[model samples]
Target: MSIKGAIKGLLATLASGCLAAAVGGIVVYAHGFSALASLRDGPLPPVQQTRLFADLAAALDGLGVILALLIVLVAGGSMAWVFLAGRFIAGPLAALRQALGDHAASLGVHLPREEAEDPWTPEGLGTTLRGLLELVASREADLVASEAHLAAVIDAIPVGILAVESTGYIRSDNLAARLLFGQTDPLVGKNLSALIAPPVHPGIPGRGKDTALDMVTRAAQTHETLAVHCWRDPSLFPADVTARTVSRGGSLTTVVTVHETTERRRAEAERAHHRALVSAALEASTDGFLVVDLDGVVISWNRRYYDLLGLDSDVVPRLPQAQRYERVRAVMADPDAFHALYDRLVNDPATTVVETMHLAGGRRLDVFTGPFRVDGVVAGRLWTERDITERERVQADMARAKEEAENALAELKETQAHLVEAEKMASLGQLVAGIAHEINTPIGIAVTAASHIADEARELAVAVKANLLRRSTFESFLETVHDSATVLLSNVRRAAELIQSFKQVAVDQTSDERRLFDLATYTQEVLLSLGPSLRKAPQRVEVDIPPDLMLDSYPGAMARVLANLVLNALMHAFPGLPAAGTRDDTPDAPREAVGFPGCLYLSARSLDDERVEMRVADNGVGMTAEVRRRAFDPFFTTRRGQGGSGLGLHIVYNLVTRTLGGRIEIDSAPGQGTCFVLTLPRRAPEVPVAAPSQCDASGTLGGDSTV
Candidate 1:
């Protein structure tokens, strides 16, 4: 039962006991008085009556005194009961009211002042206590839910999180912390120093050796986030740890947080490596390289840059942009131009400029300037300079040499022309001598016949004058005259034919005129003209050309080509044979005695409507492979000092290929007679007639050559 209810029952019990005692006392006194009155009235005299009355009066006084005593005792007992109730019940009730008010105040609820100050009542006190208890229960539920949410949020964080106490014990840890440590067991209650190591410090004993507990204590005291290294079994990684002190129920606790930095550290290492590589490349370059930012500040430069400008390396990097520019301009031949170029490059960052720079010390440099970009955005400019003084000097020397070579070539060509003209005149002179010798034979026969006829005629005239001539004698004279006349006419006609052939051959050999001529007819004429030289040689000539084959080409060049081939064969084809115009001592000498009776073969045929093929071959000791390879080379010969000009076949090759628009090839081997095959166009290319002295050895006289 409640204290107030128990006290109420006790007060009621006391009141009932007092009332019962009062009734009992009244009954006892009245009963006693009645008995005394009955004894006095039954007998007696006046003396007995007076005595009884006095006794009755005395009894009444005593009864009244007893009743008064009873009243005093009862009143005193009630006063004592009231004092006990105030001391035990009302005092405790007042203390209970004060406690309830304080709890309400703590929960931010105010209680009315009258409620605390009023006299204690069980019912009022019970109602107030029940209302305060219900409000406390509601607030407790909200606090539990808030704590659960905060724990979930901390666990969901990706960074490793650890809440450690000041004594290094792990009070709380998240999934990230467990994963980072590579652990599956609970981390709580474990010493933080056992899970993670401190940062390493070389060369300093005991430095950076602080345990996790010590670090946490220090961090809490200083209110700072400390960076440290943590161990995950085999390797150590970077981490940031922070600690704060919190008070819970009058006790101090520290909350510590840890964050890993492995990726960030790796990225920083990679960037450092790349920077080292770029620095090495720049230093290795031979050219001067410099980089400047958009604000005209020097960002970087290689050693070559300072070396090229003759500037102090240690001082240049510390100088301002304007001062650096001024120092460089001092070494330039044109300071104004250098300043202008710098301004232009800074203003137009996207443009690439290349130009030459002249130094005051007579040095030339090739300079290139372009944008330097970072992350695809133009942030600065780059300059590259290379020395080119030696290159320019070499180029000037080469130009002068080229001019001198051209002048020498022109003089050589003129000399070659003179030699070619002289050679042509020598061949013509030979042709004239041969024709004169042929004409002399025919003329001698004609003269002999005329002399015989003159003798016969004189004899006939003498007989007629004497008038004594017989008929037989006159008839003999007439027959003799007719025979002489026939002999004279035939010889004179032979001489005239020889003169005409000589005239045509000479003209054709000296001029480069184009004409249409039959192949067979021209070949025969050329061979006839070379008769003097051919007859003197031991070799014989052969011809096999189509009579109807025609060509509209340079006949003069053709004749010269034919003559050179025939003469070359006669001179070189037959060895171990007597020289020209000389004979063996033995009249009956076998053909083998003259070194294999050589024969020169000349053949031609029409290849197509616009082309022809010609062959000049010999059946004598042929040329070797080495000799034939260089047969068309200028000034090459086997008989260099034996009256062989070596130009005989060379001239022939040039004339056929260049002047006549043909190709000539040599086919020969030792002891297997040589053959020169020529393929020519029927209508030669139209070109200016080159003079004999103007033979083009380089084959540039005509458009193109196939030799």
Candidate 2:
């Protein structure tokens, strides 16, 4: 039973307890007092008459005196209890009744309180309560059903769900709601207004104005359904509250549903930010990209695409997307297949490329169309186009120039071959010149000797015939002719030796021999070949080649590489200081170095029998850091024309890096001359060996050489 019931039963027992005591006192007094006679001077009569007369008299006095007092006392006491029970009864039960009555009165909602205070009285509000209690007792089934319906609704809510009456009464709240509010039960039937803490600001609503109070209040007043959100418990979480105000039988109430939105809102914000980032990235792209739907709607086109197609966005937005796309379609190089292309783009399951689209301003675009998917289903096309017109122009220009270059290169190659031939000729010419010089001396000597021998013979014959005597003199003449004859023969043999040496040098220079040879001898053969060009300047030739150095290499290639480097230095570096446009700089030396005579040195050492490292260096002007940066760029030559082919170094670079499996490096400065170091590896480095082995010229080898 409720505490109220137990307390009420105790009060009823106490109030009745006093009445039972008063009645017992009255009963005991009547029995004891009635027996005593109050007639003090009375005489006895006959036995039967006296007994009857005496009993009658005693009864009358007892009745008038003590008996009467006892009777009156008992009656008065019983009457008082009957009257005082209503007033002296314990108040808690009555209070409960008042509470229950208020609760029932505001069953579906809170009610506007009456202005007057209720002076509780047994005859008035008490009578009304008793009748209601009797009715509840009479209809237990209906009351139970009402209670269960309310309880069931309260149990179902996972989140905090609450209902409040318009008068600020707590109508109902679920277990979660009570726990969230940190309370045990609803303040059932408590005056909602009395229980509510006053608003933070007087006359103006604060938390009170929030849904918990406001919607209930407003609905009660206006009889409208009001929905709102509020935080019921600030400590646990900011509750996403949805409140719906309602009215029932002139009573107002509001139901509140509180949901937690922390995770969901966070996820939504993150996705939104990612989408913004993607859009920004697309807009910032340099490539032209656009999207089209299966229905031919122009969805998104990057700014570059707009510019590429020469489209005005302001004009495009006014037209239907289909019309705008029609305008865009006109720019497709293959517009005839645009519709088909679009269909394919939307339908294709894999990536593919579409080529050469025409555009405004005589430009060509490269269109890359891909499928746009929505919900895992292909929806439309995402086309990315680039203006490849410039690339085409570059290709065309390169093709023509390449044709001219090839012809020129062929001619140059022919010239180089001829120069090689001329080199052979120069070798032969050196031989011829040497043979001529040596043979002229011998031939002159032989002719003079022969003439002298004839003279001597003639003299001997003349002397013998004229004199006809002197035998000693005739013998002396024969000896003189014999000596002169010996001298002539010796000179002829010397001429033959000179001719033989010339013939040998001429033959070896052109012979493609793979056999190991003396470095000094091969280098001399190369020098002999270079004699034709050297003779022009008549420059003094220095030969420092060691005779014992041996290597097995393509002598022809070695000869050619050396020739190119030497000729390049001679023709390019000190060509009169660039005719005043690029006068050579004699810059200061580096702060720390071996010495100040910035120079290029040529030397060779035998790495092995299979390899020889020939280093060619010069003392002319050198190259700077900037020059080295673009030094290897294809078709990017510092020497514009000058018959450079630009490919001179490029070809050299390729030959060393690709054809020969070697490295070509250039080290130079403003004043310090350039050194082209060719590291030829007979036993090539461990790399993937293709027929034409490619090398990375950019790879730094050993020590920094200030290249």
Best by TM-score: 1
Clashes of each: 1, 6
Candidate 2: list runs displaced more than 4 Å.
1-156, 168-170, 178-240, 245-250, 288-308, 311-326, 329-353, 373-377, 390-424, 467-470, 510-707
Which residue segments of model 1 deviate by more than 4 Å? 1-138, 184-186, 201-229, 236-266, 336-353, 370-380, 419-430, 433-440, 443-492, 566-597, 619-654, 668-673, 688-707
Q: TM-score of the candidate numbered 1?
A: 0.69
What is the C-alpha lDDT profile of model 1 across 462-570, one tens digit per residue? 9889986889988887787778778888889998998888887888887767789888898887787777887777666768887888899887788888988888888
lDDT of 2 by residue, 262-289 (tens): 5666787899999888878987887887
Worst 10 residues of 2 by lDDT: 66-75
Report the backbone clash tally of model 1. 1
Overall lDDT per candidate, in order of appearance:
0.68, 0.53
